[model samples]
Target: MKGHRGSILDIAVVADGQNVISSGQDGTARLWDSAQGACIAVVDDSYSPINAIAVAEVGNAVNLGSPKETPSNREVGTEGKLVVLAREDKSLEGVSLHSRQSVFDFEGSDAFNCCTFISSVGVLAGGLDGNIIHVDITNPKSAVETVSWSETPVLSLVPFRDTYVASYGNGTCYIPLKGSEQVLQLTGPNRQPVFQVAAWKKLVYTCCRDGFIRKYEIPDLG
Candidate 1:
């Protein structure tokens, strides 16, 4: 599991198998063969310490919720992409995992803290200025920004189910993936800042700056 030479900022497990990709403050992304614990590929990004990494299946694939019994002969094409947040300029870089090449770069208002790719809406980047930049990877030239309360810097962005959960200085907010504009805000005691938020199964976990990892059950909204 140890791949990067420096601090590992983020690690993402591919949906296909036992392979994991890690990004670090070391400015490089390394692909690790989890079964063998060996580094397979190193994607160099100069000295721009990478803060986040996400991997998703490309093209028309089986829905994530499908049962294992479903027969699938889907061929994985080399069309997946990786989104990285560079600490130096607070910028976001899109690199194709299949090609291992830098595809495009998007500038944000301030230093970007983290980023994640939304399967339906493109790449979402969180910054120090409390703004979220949405970049359409298919058309990198046209990116959009969604303004937010400017008091706190966003540290992490995690998309779960159909909502995007964002963690900042003192709380976490869940934004709907579509439809009417609405936000579900969860505040912590004494306004403790949350550093990271992750969603798995029907639970959401938040790592707080107060050195506590809290888990919240996601209520059925169906």
Candidate 2:
């Protein structure tokens, strides 16, 4: 909580919640001891402000490059995982948790606002331009897909079953189905930006700028 020199932008839990990883406006990503609230390690550094981050346990799901040196003994729950950084400089990068080295860096149309891993090898990075660019970790040079439901900057993303939910600055949220062009919208926020979203048991929840959290009971998608 106190190690970041600048404002903390986003955070993710790692090591099954024993530790927390945070991204800061100071351009650093740090790991922390959850119970002790102590800074564990400065995991990464970026030239641009890291706007968001997400961690995933991706054992053999994708190739997170080997570390050049022996990993520090203090690094706990860092192996066999990956961290995705959404930066303010129109770049989205993937880093190996164990190595803390960038595995892939891809260019985005605009500054990335948020990111999340939808599957073992599939990643979704939403940009300021409202473009949600999908990347395949195995082949990150090119975008697997990019969709823009609206021109407003994307605010958040949450992976749902077989599809993912995206929230936007314009107070719009959508669920885009895989292998199809159709999308479902989550309505209610009346022009207030939907800041974040989370999914559980087919239910979706949104945190809005209007100082209220909304929950949606989704119907059967099959």
CA lDDT, every model vs. true structure: 0.67, 0.89
TM-score of 2: 0.94
Expressed as tens digits, the lDDT of each residue in 78-149 for candidate 1 is: 244353444547667766555566667777778788788777437788888888778776566767657575
Clashing pairs in 2: none
- Looking at candidate 2, what is the lDDT of residue 192? 94
Which ten residues in a row are the worst by lDDT in model 2? 67-76
Off by over 4 Å in 1: 1-3, 60-86, 200-202, 217-222
lDDT measured at residue 189 in model 1 versus the true structure, 0 to 100: 35
lDDT of 2: 0.89
- Residue pair clashes in candidate 1: 90-112, 169-193
Model 2: per-residue Cα lDDT over 65-158, one tens digit each: 7878886555678888999999999999998887777888999999999999998888999999999999988789999999899999999988
Task: Tell me the TM-score of each prediction against the true structure.
Answer: 0.79, 0.94
Minimal lDDT window, size 10, model 1: 62-71
